[model samples]
Target chain A: MALGLAALLFIVLCALPVFYMLGVSLVGADGAFSLNHYFRLFAEVRQLDLFLNSLLLATATSLLATAIGAPLGVLLARADLPAKRALRILLIIPLAVPPYVMGLAWIYMGSDSGIIAQATGRDFLSPLTYSLTGAVIVLSVSFYPLAMLAAEAAARGVDARMEEAALLVAAPRRVLWRITLPIAAPSIAAAALLIFVLALSEFGVPGLLRVPVFTTEVFTAFSALYDFGAATALAVPLLALALMAGITARFMIGERLLVGRRGARNRSPLSLNSRRAGLAVTIALALFVLLPIAALALETGRAERMILALRSSVEAITNSLTLAFVGATMAALIGLLLGYARARMHRFAGTVDLAMIVAFAAPGTVIGVGLIGLWNRPGLMEEIYRSRLIILIAYLARLIPVAALILAAGARQVPASFEEAGEVAGAKWTRVFARITVPQMRAGIIAAWVVSFILAFGELGATVLVAPPGQATLPAHIYTLIANAPSGEVAALALTQSAVVMTLLALFAVFVFREKRLHS
Target chain B: MNDSFLRLVNIVKRFGRREVVRNLSLEAAEGEVVALLGPSGCGKTTVLRVIAGLEAPDEGEVWIAGRKVASDGINIEGPRARHVGFVFQDLALWPHMTVAGNLDFALASVSVARRERAARITEALRMARIESFASSYPDQLSGGEQQRAALARAIVSRPGLLLLDEPMSSLDTELKGELIGEIAALQRSLQVTTVYITHDRAEAAALAHRVAILREGRIERIDEIASL
Candidate 1:
């Protein structure tokens, strides 16, 4: 009972802000009931423009990210590539960069006092940061990890024996297309939809680049203009779009796509054997993944950069760590409840799980917009909206699904006989769950918490719009510093944030390694 | 006459369009060792699960110690409420838990005080001869150790009925013989009604007081092991 309530409390708190956003969006005018705000979106041209921009950005970004990420995923999962571990880590490192930070990095590369201007002695601001192309680049870089991870997961789930059978029958290419890709298509589509939803609600990249999209419009209406009704109306379109994308993604990729069966084969990276092709791909990867960080490092000399970065480093680290801790703890608790609910409530499990997945697909900024629209009204939430509590709520709504999926997968691996053993020992369901279920899922719970922590710490889109003014997180802080400060100062801050993220990842890697050793 | 400890009457189970366990009847008398022996896909495991209330039968009934727990499409009790213990082929001991914790989790709500629970743990551990490995986690234990741990956990609750599903399948030949001897001794000591399922004819012949051979989801023969 205690465990269940803890789980319930965690889920309720996480879900409250997003649910309240929807509830408030439905509130009527004249101090009564109406769908005026929802209807008003269609009547406004600017709202429609912003809606289209968001849709275009999401669709284009998902496709581009998937296109680039799919080959990389295949190389990592199935090929016998050289330096496999090193390349995998290198490809994944870009994920540690927050979306706003990536935008800031691009700004440094393309702004008036930027690297391109400094290097080429020509102003390139017209085609760079302040355009839609910039927004696409930012969103694509921010989300390609989704595609890569999905492809790898899908490829891993294919039974090696099946592939081997195809190879022996002299149908390698046929098997690759028909058997492998089709079997894993659900996961690839799911990844693309996730990226699409993420791009749809992204606000910071577009905001930084001055590309007007729905999320930015909603942010402007609420925060700048203080027009709650107008903002709510604009957000209605985004909400509908988010729901549509989630449903479409769910249909394209089933729930099983989210949870893959871990296989035992040692995945070897693909060999890029053609000399010219190898060099070309390597150069492309280096440009995409390594060049920005390298420039950030070079622009800021190591000594001066370290000194400036260290000044506020302690405070930023503390804030990021604390928020991540809270978010992870909250997410883990909710994950436990959801996992249990899925396991125990067999009949309604699929539907409830689908709802959670859809909510997960909804982006942080969209949730933030919804929260503001809901709470900034002339009502009880007016008070809550003014506090840091609202930001926490936004984080909860955006992150719980991630933790739940991990926990659910882990929970499923536990055989039913363990629970049965407890019951046969005369333990009630409640007691059995506490003594058996909780203990068995401890590692999964911890892993879920860690994942949530990493994601929450790097979250920029929602935090940029929702965080109380001047209370900048690491990502937000770096973004602002990059816009105004010298190249060295900005690079120092970016490097520091990267270091913090890398350190957490290292710790997590150590835990995973230990677990594997223990199991083996 | 008193009823048998556990009974299954005309149980039928189907998956999709195929019937896995066709109208099958089975019973385990008090303190009797009843072994359901069969080849793969013969539905021995399905029948055992049905009796344990883990799987529902499309037809027929189940009784435990004179009480009808499932019958005529009515399942009045779930697996937890059936007071039945199951030992899976994989052991299914919680891998993250210590050996002692494994036993304690099973005996969670029993009125045993902390000291008494510890004593019970010690007794079960000693009985299973796994006392020295009490603090070790399941993954650290050997296959034989896991077999012992599974048995200790199942019997710790003093269940009215016990079910073992291919208990020695994962063990080596040496460990299998050793564990099988220990299990037979433990069953004799506890006098618990047990229904052991195995595909191995030799195992059933060696351990069961009465052995039932199942073929294609139906009973081919049920007789005393000595006569068989």
Candidate 2:
């Protein structure tokens, strides 16, 4: 019953704003329901351009990320490379860096007086540096780690004997092409679709790169132009696209969405020979990992300026950290209940998962517009909407589905008999869940909390749209600061934000390692 | 006066200090069926892998069809270059491929002409009695049909040597007996040196000219099944 209520509360909190905005979009000036907004959207060439831009950007990002990530995943999982742990650590750190910050770093690297210009005395890439192509490149570098992780898991999941069987009659290359890659196709393609959804839903990269995508248009209509009707209408197409992509990705992955690769230690017969693959891997790491962070540092220049900028932005930093803490706690509690319920459910589970995927994929601009429409009017909700709690609401709306999915994967590992034993001891359902299940899922809960914190810390799309006056979160504030603040200060804040996120991730890893040690 | 088509000269293999195949030596004559019978984990399969060039021995030499393919610490030739047909215990049929496609891939590696490749695949599928399921993926086929397709793929290349590692382990008693008979007849007609590894003594006795008993990574004895 408690778990049911958790799911119910999440649905009600999330559905109301979205449905409100959706309903508002359907109403014409006469306030009667109609499809005129959609009609107008299709009739306008500008709207069509928006759709094409988003589609092309998403496709390019998906393709490029996969092109880089799939081969890298294969090497990491199958090769006998030296110092793999360090390499993985380096590769994964990019995942924690927000794409908008990477866009800034790239800007500093490729601008007229930027790093490349200083080094080579010319800006050869200046023209392509802040265009649609730039957005695709930034988003790919930011998102390829997702594909890499998925491909690595899928590669590891293959049984060694499968490849060995193919090897007997075919060359190694043939065996790889026919046997290994085919087995990992579902995972690779699913990851590509996921990247597509994330790219379509993204706001920061396009906004930073000066691309006129739907998300930017929605922000313009609502925040800048004060045209609520146009904002909701603009959000409709992106909402549909995100939902379609999310559902397609979910189906492509199927039941294994929550099930990761089984044995990561399984060895393949194929060996990584010579230093050629090693040289290529080194160049990739340098391109993806080292270059961006180094650019941020080069732009920031010194520790003293970063510290000074950090001091001046103390309010924004505190607001971000405090709200994210509370928001992540709420997300964890809700995710745990929903995840346990989803894991134990027998029917309608797929439907619930579909709903979660759709909610998670809904564009942040759409969610922000929906929240304003639902709660900006005079009421008790208005009180919450005026305070920092509204920001928490935005975070929960964005993050709970992802947290629940993570927890659900963890919950599935536990045996049913363990819960039954708790019930057999005369414990109530809630008690049985707490003592028998939650204890077993401690690592998952901590992990979900950490992810929630990072996402909330870096959140800008909805947060920018919904953040109360004088209470701007750090991410939203840095974005606003970029327009007027000194270049050093903005770069400093971006670096600080990245540093805080990495520190949190590092702490979480340590805690998880300690928990594993204690358990074993 | 010898007909040793597949030879292993005192091969030693280990998995991180746990010795799996210790100074193992065996030879199969041309058109001969030698079954390596042992308990599970006794490294019978490892020896077959060594001969197939899928694995290199730690301390010995392997010669297939009178060419040294592997020696201590090095493999001179890969499995495909050695022209070996191997049937894994789990069948390992390509799940994405049709039954005919599986056979075609094996034949394709040998650079067979496309026109002749179809006929060879059809002939192999027909010999294995799975010609009806030529268009079906591995998962779509019944267990017995899948077993037949595995056999078809292994021999579709007409390899100089064949290795079978308990290909009928998952089938029931009747299916197993039928497959055993089919395999024996297929081997005789193909006239290729074959090595069959299994834990079942009865299977060894039924399908092999000679059965070699293995215990603790060492060969206990080798004798004709009739003599045993």
Candidate 3:
């Protein structure tokens, strides 16, 4: 009964906005069924350009990310390397730092009088800096870790004995090519598709780079033009793309999407030349992780400017931290119930997974538009729309699906027999869950919270659209300051945001390490 | 013993601080089926692995077919160069490939010509009584069929030595008896030096010319199957 309520709440909170948008898009001004909005969306040259741009960006980013990430993943999973754990954590730092911050770094590095110009005494990279290619590069750098981690997990999950079986008659290289990579291919492809969807859905990087994608167009349609109908129309293609990609990814991954199991006892036979691989990894780290951060710090100039930037944006920062904290807690609590239900349900679990993936994959601008259409009404709905509460709602809508995914993966790790044992000992269902299940899921719960908080803290697309006047979050504030305020201040704020996210991730990593040590 | 086709001398394998196989030594003559019989964690599988060159012992040497394949703490020749076949406990059939494809992969690895590969694959499938499932993937086949497929893949390359790591552990008693008889017949025909690891005493007795009982990584005794 409790699980049913949680599912209902999830549907209402997460699914309703998208559904409402779909419904609203199908209706004309006369309140009758119509296809005029879609017709207009299809007929316009500008809309066509937007569609192509979105498609190109998503495709390019996914391809580049996979090309860079899959080899690293193979190395991480199979190679004999030094300080692998540390390297892994460092590589993942780009994912935690928001893409827009990376965009800001690129802007600072490639601007007319920026770092590159000052160093080289010429403005060579500025043309490529604030363009679609720039957006693709920035987003790929920010999101490649997703592909890397996915590929690594999938590779590790392959039975080592299977490779050994091949090794009996084949060289190690042949075994890897014929057996290991083929087995891990489905998962790698799925991660690439997911990266495509994420890149397609992303708003801030494109907006910063002045790339006219669907997300940025939707923002302009609603926020600049006040054309709600146009905004909803613009979201249709993006939503369709996301839905298709999510369903395809889910099919490719199946149950392994959430749960990663370690393989057999034998070590993989495939090995890399550690010195050369280490050199490549170090170079990648320099390019993808350290360069952007150094640019941000360099552009921020001095410590005093950072302090002043912090003082000026203190309200926005505080608002962001508080809202993200509450949002993450609620998301984790709700995710716990829903995730447990999804994990345990033998039937309808695929449907639940589909819904969660689609929800999570829906672009934030689309969700923002949907929320506005749903909540910007009279009475109680208007109360939410006109206050800071709407931002939290937006956060929940955008974040719950991911939190549920993390928690569901956690729930799967706790064996069913443990709960059955608790029940056999005369414990009630709730008691068994609280004592036997939740305790075992402690690490998962913490992971869900930390991930949710990071995502919510960096959330910009939905929050920017839905936040009331004077209730700007740090991302929205930094975004606005990009046009008017000094570059130093904007760089400082972006640096501060990255620092907070990195610190939280570090703490979570430390906690997880300690937990593993304790258990082992 | 001097003409043994497969030999392990004072093998010691450790995982972390636990010595899984310690000071264990054994030998099997050419065409001999020697069963390494032990309870779980008695290092039976480790011994098979050492002979196969899949593992290097920390303090021993392994010789296969008159060649030194591994020395203390090093694999002088890897598993492929040793020409040993292994059927893991889980079967470990490549799920992405058909049974024919699996066999073809093994054959092709040894530089078998494409023109001759099909005939070899067909003969192996026929020997294992799994010709009907040649185009089927491992998951598409039944448990018994999968077992046959694994066995066919192992022997398709005509390996000098064969290692079976409790491959029949998951089967019921009836199926186990059937497969054991088939395996014994296959071994007699192929005349490959074989090391079968199993905790089941009856299985060891039914298939082996000699049974070496292992207790805590040490040989307790080697009894002739006829005596048992």
Candidate 4:
């Protein structure tokens, strides 16, 4: 079946590289199977420190993000706040902008000559600008919407009658605490764990913040020291941590996590009327949504410099745009089949969910190292590994699972009876899928494509690791120049990244609105 | 002055100008049972909701236990403030709470002391004949058992007015008949003012002191139902 090939493609592209790295981690210099690599990994105090730093960073990001996002999510789902739809869209704009660009904005705000210093005529935030706490703040602000969305879904999942039953006797606040929040605990915890994994796997934020985490160390080991063994070894711990967290999150959410919250729209029982909730949403919008973006624009003032910055990094920009397009297109196409297969699958689907999340959560540095271990050999494999094709491979490995998950969520919306109706009419399975099922899920498909494109465009971690020597993507170039280049030029590049991403996001939003109108 | 404990006067409810309930008026005396019978979409549930203070009337006045609770374009009191017990058509039992916890929540809502909550909940469970299933969640209990739990939750706070909206709509004929008998006995013993909303004429005849047949959101007829 076509679905089998899509599944097989993921197994070969994503799964094999990880397995290859696992094999490499197990083998010693003598070419004998051994635990020496792991032994050495734990034995070195520097490695242990790196591991601890990564853990703390992940923990802090998860906790802080949840703290900020969970309340907002609850408000969005239950509050009778004004301009709710606008507020939700504004809050989610951060997800469109890459985390590193956010880090860059924060840096500009907190640097010695940056916004905070110039405005205040003193430097308080500059000391903590490139610190672990700074990384946590940037990553948390960038990823908080994940928690927010998850929280809203979980809150909506609570049946209206359940709350009304409580409201018959208990106060609304008591009903929320005792009935709504407790029921939503699994989703909130799952979102927290997901944030933890994402923060741990993140390379851009911590790297920019000068936080010496596993990802950065792995980069240093391979790129600077040329010690492939050491780099691969460093990745094992991060890989293990991301996989564990991803699997745990998947289990916590179960199959319902993939079912979108369309069912929640009709049942609106919990209505909160409070001025304080409105104030909280406004403050959150100003702080998390508007502030960083305003800082970025303020730092990059002139149009001419932005033009010059784009021209200078022209090769990198071209490569990034082209590769991202190709990568997103491939990911969407392949993800459709995989998503459909997964949606229709009844038995052992949990295992598939676990596998996808683990793959999707694998640290970019680890996947890059795994790809090199698997393909950097003499003959045909070496030939392909040295080309730009390898970079595309990295993108496929990193992003396909995410795309598939999105599509699967969409696919689940189509009732099984629709497909069954087609089959009963003597249509083939492919025809049934295309004419009946796919048409019903058109919105989900477009959403999946847009999300996939955005993620692919902003991808840096794995691309940075796997890019051929002397080659640079826009992100890799901007990051490399930040140390030595003028603030104006760096700001321009960062702003350009935001502009392109936002413009595409606007287009996608328009497309979705148009589709909704047509459907209506 | 109305002689009834629960009264709705010239109540009007509209959802986007469809006018669900138009100039509807009803009353139930203290410690009396009155059944409002109608076809589906006859605004029977809306009347119950208006009385329970869950839904505000567009043009009407609702008074519970001699206190004005809601009027045209204003909800003067919330469901909790009016001390009303409402069991929805679906028997909206909180799935998260155990049967005892459900009763406890009801008692707590009426601001009962934590110490007395346990005893009150037990007595409520005993009255509903579901004492052995105190630890059971709504989903864990059988349909009949769950029905008892919902009844227990409603009466736990000892509300001045009790509203039932097709509570046995999902039950089989055997269980429905049994619950109807039990509910009648409980209403007689407790002597709380009650309004029963149902489409089934048999249900109306089985429990009510009087039956009001509703058509197009208006009272078509009022007949005294002889005791079954």
Candidate 5:
């Protein structure tokens, strides 16, 4: 009964926004069923431009990310490089630093009065810095880690003996091409498609770089033009694109989307030259991880400015921290029940997985518009919408699906027999869950919370749209300050956000290492 | 011993701090079937890997077909150049390829002429009695058919040495008996130098001309099957 309630809540919180948007998009001004919004979307050249630009960004980002990330993944999985654990963590730091923040760093480095301009006494890079290419670069740098991690896991999952079987007749390179890569191709392709969808759905990087994609266009139509109908129309293309990509990725990845299991103990057939691979890793870290951060610090200039920026944005920062904490807790708790149900489900689990993937893939601006359309009027919901609670609801709408995915992967690791044994001992379902199941999945629960907190903290697209007056989160404040406030203050705030996320990640890593030691 | 086609001398292999194969030595004459029989983790499979150049021993030498393939913690020759055929315990058939495709890949790797490749694959499939399943992927085939496909893939390149590591462990007893008989006949006809690893004494006794019993990481004794 609890599990059923959790599923119902999941649908209500996560799925309803997308459904409401779909329903609204189909209704005309006359309140009759119509396809006029889509018709207008198709007829307008500006809309076509938006579509093409979004497609170009997503495609280029996916291809570049995969090109850079897949080989790095193979190297990490198969090469005899030094300090592998540290290298992986360092590579992943760019992902934890949100794309918008990275965009800010690039702007500081390349804008007319920015670092490069000061260093070179010229404005050579500003054109590329503020263009669509800039958006793609920033988004790719932020998302390639997704592809890298996915490819690493996929490569590691290939049976070592299969490669060995090929090795007996073929060279290591041929074996890698014929045996290892072919087996891992599906997963790597799925990850690329997922990155494509995420790039399409991204609002902040494109918005910051002045790229007029669907997500940014949706935000403009709603906030600047006050044309709700136009915004809803703009969001339809993004929704359809996300749905298609989500279903395809889910099909390609199947149950292994989140559940990572290492294969046998034998060494892989493929091994890269350690020195060359190490050089590549170093260059990547410098370009993607260190450069942007150093730019931020350089622009921020001094410690006092960072403190002053923090003090000025104290309310927003506190709101972000408190809301992320509460939101992550709620998301983790709800995700635990839903994930347990999804994991134990023998039927319709695929359907549930598809729904979660679509919800997670839905662009933030689309969900924000959907939430406004759903709750901006009508008694109780209107009251909630007028208060700070609407921002929390937005967080739930955006984060619950990802939390459930992480927790479901965790839940799948615990065997069913453990619960069955609890039942045989006459323990109630709640007791069994609390004592036996939850204890076993403690690591998953913490991981889910940490992931949720990070996502919610960096969340800007939905929160900016849904926040009540004077209740802005840190991301919203930083975004609004980008154009109005001093560049130094904005850089300091962005740097602060990155620091918080990195500290949390470091702490999580420490916890994991300690757990591994204790268990070993 | 000097004329042995496959030889291991003073092999010592360690994974981390634990020694897995400790100063083990073994030999198989040309066309002879030697079974390294032992309990699980008795280093029999490691010995097969060492001989095939899949692994280099920490303190030993391996000679296959009169070539020093590995010595002093280094692989002098890689697995491909060693011309070895290995059938792993799990079979490890490539799932993405059809049975014929698998055999074709093996033959092509050895630089078999493209014009003769189809006939070689067909001959291998025919020898393994899996000719009708050439178009089928490994997952589409039955357990026994998959085993035959794995065996066909192993011998497709006409390798100089053959290594089998509990290839029939997953099959039922009746099928195991039938496959064992077929394998013995195939070995006799091909005259390939073979090293078979098994924990089952019955399998060792049934097909091996000689059995080397191992305990921990060392050989306890070598017995001629005629004496057994």
Candidate 6:
């Protein structure tokens, strides 16, 4: 019964945001339900342009992220890369850096007095950080890890014996094209779709780069215009696109990759012999990964100037941490219960999992819009929205799906028989869960906790739209700091944010590694 | 003997449209080792689980040590109340548990004193020839050792009827032969009624006093090793 309640809690947490958006999208300034807002969205060419810009940006980011990520995935999974373990770790750290921080780092490099501008003598804003192309570059860098992780996992799933068979009959290129790529297609498509959804919902890069995508327009409507109805209406297209992409990604990646065998840990790393290949990968890493980080670090040295520039970064850090803790705690509790239910009660698992993912795929702006639409009415919920409770609810809405997915992955490894064995031995279901199930899934629980925490900490899209007056999160604060401060201070503050995020992520990675060692 | 220990009457289980265990009925005497032998997917494991109450039959009844655990008209008890011990094919030994923890979990409801529980764990480890490895995790142990740990865990509760579901499938050829004799010896010494399921005919013939071969969810024959 407790498990059931937990599932209901998570499901409601996910649904309320989307429904709230839907309610607000339909309601008008006159406080009556109407279709005029949506009609206005289609009829206005500028609004339509914003929609197109977001769509095109999402498509480009997906392609670019996939193109960059797929080869590296193949290298990591199939080829022998130098310092492979260190490289894998480095690749994942980018994910830990919040998208807004990445934007600030780019701004520091590309701005008029930016380090890159000083060093290269090229106008920083000439072609990047202030245009549509700049948005794509930033979004791709932020989201490529999605493609990298998924493609690598899929590459690992291909039987080495099949590759051997292909090698026996043909050249390496033919074998790769004919057998390996085809086999890894589902995962590749899944990765692309994931990147697409991420790009569609992205607010920070486009906002920082001064591009007016749909998310930005929504933010503008809420913050500047205070037109909650228009903001809610603007998010409808993004939500629909994300939902469609998420569904297709699910179908393409189906149940085949769901159950990973224990033997997957034994994958043999492929060797790369060409020096040119090594040079290419190193150069790519240098340009895309190292450059941004170097710029952020250089900017950090001018700490006094940065401190003078942005006052809100420090307070935003505290608020971000609080919301992150709340979101992580709620997600972990809800995730554990839902994972338990799905593992034990087989009947409703698919439906529950789908509901959670649907909630995740819905854009944060939509959620913010939804919350305002639903609770701005005079009622008990209205009071809750006026407080800190609604912000936490937004975090749950965005994070539960990720927590559930990671936990579910961990829960799958635990054989149902363990629980059955415990029950038959005379323990109650709750006792069995506590004594047997929880211990076995400790690593997964930790991973879920960290994932939700990091995602929550960096969360900006929904917070930007819905954060009550005087309430600013870390990312939102850092963002405002960049615009409000001079180049040196912006750079310094961005560096501090990066350091804190990297430290937390490193600690999480270490914990996960220890858990793996404990289990293995 | 002892009110038929554990019994099943006309158990029917279906997956969507296909019946996996069709009108299957079986019983365990007080201390008999009745091996449910069958080809892959013939529903032998399903029968073992039905008795242990891990599964509920669509259209019949299961009585565990004289208590009605499940029936067509009513479901009386869950797996916990059945007082049954099952050794899964996967050896689903809790990977997080040490050998001692595995045994302690099984013996939780036995009403044994704390000291008695500790003593029973030591005895179970000794009986399974895994005493030296009691502190180790399941993954750290060899396949044969894990099999032994699973058996020790199942038997620690002193269940009236024990179910072994392809318990030796994970072991190597050499360990399989060695452990078969050890398991048979433990069964004889403890005199626990056993329903051992296996697709391996040799294992069924070697470990079972009476082997019942099931084909396509129905029992084809029950015979002694010499007769086979």
Per-model DockQ against the true two-chain complex: 0.01, 0.71, 0.83, 0.67, 0.89, 0.01
**lDDT by residue for model 3 (B17-132), tens:** 99988898888899999999989988898888888777789988998878888998999998889987788899999999999999999999999999899999999999999999
TM-score to native of every candidate shown: 0.64, 0.96, 0.97, 0.96, 0.96, 0.67
Q: Write the per-residue lDDT of candidate 2 for residues B60-167, one digit (tens) a residue.
A: 999887888899969999887898888988888878788888888878877899999999988998989989999999999888989899989999998888899988
Can you write out model 5's per-residue Cα lDDT over A1-520, one digit (the tens) per residue? 8888888878888999888888888889999999988888788888778899999999999998898889889889988888787788889888888789999999988888777788789999888998988888888899899889878988998988998888888888888888888999998999899899999999999999999999999899899998788888788788889888988887887888656655656767677688898889889998888889988999999999999999999999999999999999999999999888888888998888889988998889989999998889989989999988999999998889998999999899999999999999999999999999999999999999998999999999999899999999999999999989999999999999999999988888888888988999
C-alpha lDDT of candidate 1 relative to the true structure: 0.73
Clashing pairs in 1: A28-A34, A79-A268, A79-A269, A81-A269
Segments in model 4 whose C-alpha atoms lie over 4 Å from true places: A265-269
Scored by TM against the true chain B, the candidates give: 0.95, 0.98, 0.97, 0.96, 0.98, 0.94
Candidate 5 residue pairs that clash: none
Q: Model 4 - which docking category?
A: medium
Put down candidate 3 lDDT per residue, A1-520, tens digits, no spaces. Answer: 8888878878888999989888888888899999988887888888778899999999999999998888888888988888787789889988888888989999988889777788789999899998989998899998899889978987887888888888888888788889998999999999899899999999999999999999999999999998888888888888899888988988887888778655646666667678878888899899888888888999999999999999999999999999999999999999999999888889988888989988998888889999988898999989989989999999999888998999999999999999999999999999999999999999999999998999999999998899899999999999999999999999999999999998998898789789978989
Any residue pairs clashing in model 6, and if so which? A20-A370, A21-A370, A79-A270, A80-A270, A306-A489
Interface RMSD over true interface Cα atoms for each candidate: 19.8, 1.3, 0.8, 1.6, 0.8, 21.6
lDDT digits (tens) for residues A1-520 of candidate 4:
8888898989998788878877877788899988887787788888778989999999999999999889889999899888676677678878788899999999988878777788789999988898999999999998899889888888987877677767767788888888889888788999899999999999999989889999988888887888777787787888789878877877777777688544453365677775878999889888887778777877877888888888899998888889888988888888999998899889988888878888888888888878887888999999889898898899899888988898888888888998898899999999998889888878777777777777877888888878887677788788889889987899898888888887887787678678867879
Order of quality (lDDT): 3, 5, 2, 4, 6, 1
Model 4 Cα RMSD, 1 decimal: 2.0
Error of 1 at B220 (Å): 34
Label model 6 with its docking quality class. Answer: incorrect
Preferred candidate (DockQ higher): 3 or 5: 5
For lDDT, candidate 1 versus 5, the one ahead is 5
Task: State iRMS for model 1.
Answer: 19.8
Q: Of 3 and 4, which scores higher on lDDT? A: 3
lDDT for position A458 in model 1: 79
What RMSD does model 2 have? 2.1
Q: For residue B175, what is the lDDT in candidate 3?
A: 92
lDDT of 5 by residue, B40-83 (tens): 88888888888888888999999987888899899999888998
Ranked by DockQ, the better of candidates 1 and 4 is 4
TM-scores of chain A in all candidate models: 0.87, 0.96, 0.97, 0.95, 0.96, 0.92
